[model samples]
Target: MDLRQLRYFVAVAETRHFGRAAERLHMAQSPLSQAIRQLESQVGATLFERTTRRVDLTPAGTSLLEDARRILAGVEDARRRVEQVAAGTEGVVTVGATDLAAYRLLPRLA
Candidate 1:
C-alpha cells in the first residue's frame, strides 16, 4: 500500500528471512512484520507463508511481487528522467547535413 511496505516486502522476498530482511532494511523485526501484516490486510491476501524455520511466498505474494517490481522500476525511471530534464540533457537532439557537407564540415566540427 505504501512505498515503505513495498520495500519491506521486497526485502523479505529476497532474503526469505524476517530477521535478515529487517537487518538489511535497518529496522526492527517487529515493525517489518507489522508492515507485512498490514499489506496483507490491505490487499486481502496473505503474502508469505511463515514458519519457525523459513518464509516463503504465497501465490498472491508472487503475483504482487511482479507488480511491485514494475512499480518500483517506473518510479526509478521517472526520477531519472526528471533529473535529466532538470539538468537540460533529457530531450531529443537532431543533427542534419548533406553528404557533401559531411565530407567537409564534419571534419572541421570534429
Candidate 2:
C-alpha cells in the first residue's frame, strides 16, 4: 500500500524470515510481523508462504517483488538526481581570456 509497507515486504521477501528482517530493519519482531500482516491485508493476498521451517513466496509475491524493486530503485534514482542538481548549484564559474576575441565573446555573453 505505502512505501514503508513495500519496504517491509521486500525485506521479508529477501530474508525469508520475519525475525531476521526485523533485526536488519532495527525494529522489533512483533511490529515487523504486524506490518507484514497489514500489508497482506491491504493487498488482499498472501505474499509469502510461511511455516515453522521456512518462508517462501507465492506467485503473487513473485510478481510484486519485481514491481517493488523497480519502484524503490526509481525513487532512489530520482532522489540522487535531485541531490546532484542541488549540489551543482553551490558553486561559481570563471573564465579567462588573453586575447581581444575572447574578451569580446565574454562581453557578448554578459
Report lDDT per candidate.
0.94, 0.89
Tens-place lDDT digits, model 2, residues 1-110: 88888898899999999889999999998998898889889889999998998889999999999999999999998888888778895345677776885777867977
Identify the runs in model 1 with alpha carbons over 4 angstroms from their true place.
Answer: 92-110
TM-score of each: 0.81, 0.80
In candidate 1, position 78 carries an lDDT of 95
RMSD of each: 3.9, 4.9
User: In model 2, which regions exceed 4 Å deviation?
Assistant: 89-103, 106-110
Candidate 1 lDDT at 18 equals: 98
After TM-score superposition, the amount by which residue 65's alpha carbon in candidate 2 deviates from its true location, in angstroms, is: 0.6
